[model samples]
Target: MKKILYILVLGGLMSCQKEKETVLKEDIQFLKIKNGLIESSYYENVESIKPIDGFIPNDSTAIRIAETILYKVYGENNIVKQRPYNIALKQDSIWCIQGNLPEGWEGGVFYIELNKNNGKVEKMFHDK
Candidate 1:
């Protein structure tokens, strides 16, 4: 029993140690130059989501980057709409935020605030 308890404790610690992603304010490129995955879509999920982009970022590729961070924080299907807002590459890397969501038919609304300096975001809570 003691050994089992020890293993359980270790597992808990390991699972809780989810590494956070850090996005620099100056290193964000809207388009993926490495794999040439620009103008891609998350057709697997998230429907009715119209294509949205901005100037300087012809395709708002920053959204994909932001979505990656959000997915890490809140497992799949948590972020429903990952849209970019206020995308401007002025001197510093563009700073933007997106909305996330829970499972199906959730009337409740949720939003995620972006922290470009660290490239991570926490779920913003509001009273229903």
Candidate 2:
């Protein structure tokens, strides 16, 4: 009787394992199909999309782009400390962004100059 009980338990465990494997395979196949559909749809519609007027159209756009790069190169905390950034347009097509220090603070800030029309980074440096 004990041997028979052990055989039954082992069989149940094997069946459960097989069920899990089947579910996993189904999930993987579903993900593959969904991914393929999304990719194909994007490619078909991408060419019809209109081009943007300018890569860095405004001051806010320039700031967002600068912050993204700054966060990656410098730590988030370090970059956030230098708020109230100074932004200017040079030659009507270049964005000049510089980080600012708080009152009475004395330290070098990050500076980035890029082309507003094409979104090209012409110069980037952090003052020491």
Candidate 3:
């Protein structure tokens, strides 16, 4: 009986660890886009941006970068329809921008941290 109880507890812990790992993996996939660059749709419409030679995007431009990918994934008028909030520049030229869910939405928020020098996203995640 003791051995059986121990086994059951161990199994439960392992399952919980696996679930945590899966959530992390999904978060990574959701944030990262192919080649870590803006898709063609943004270039087609936004003349200020250059895809090949990435620009040093500031607070406003960082929002554009986030929106470029968000618009692609969530469509033009979806979760990202509203502008990102709390755009701030951190040490080492890292720019952080957050997109919030619609009013009364259950989900918490999405964050994009990018480099100011080359406009490359260092990390992105959706928080619940």
Give the number of the best model, judged by lDDT.
2
Clashing pairs for model 1 are: 23-119
lDDT of 2 by residue, 74-115 (tens): 878878888889999999889999999998998889999978
Q: What digit string (tens of lDDT, one per residue) describes model 1 on residues 50-99?
A: 32332224324555665566567665465544232334433343444535
C-alpha lDDT values of all predictions: 0.46, 0.85, 0.72
Model 2, residue 61: distance off in Å is 0.6
Residue 117 of candidate 2: its Cα lDDT?
Answer: 76
* Candidate 3 residue-wise lDDT, 18-88, digit = tens: 99999999776655666877455545755564644247545778777777876676566654544547788
* Residue 36 C-alpha lDDT in model 2: 35
Report clashes for each candidate as comma-separated counts.
1, 0, 0
TM-score of each: 0.29, 0.59, 0.47
TM-score-wise, the better of 1 and 3 is 3
Sorted by lDDT (best first), the order is 2, 3, 1
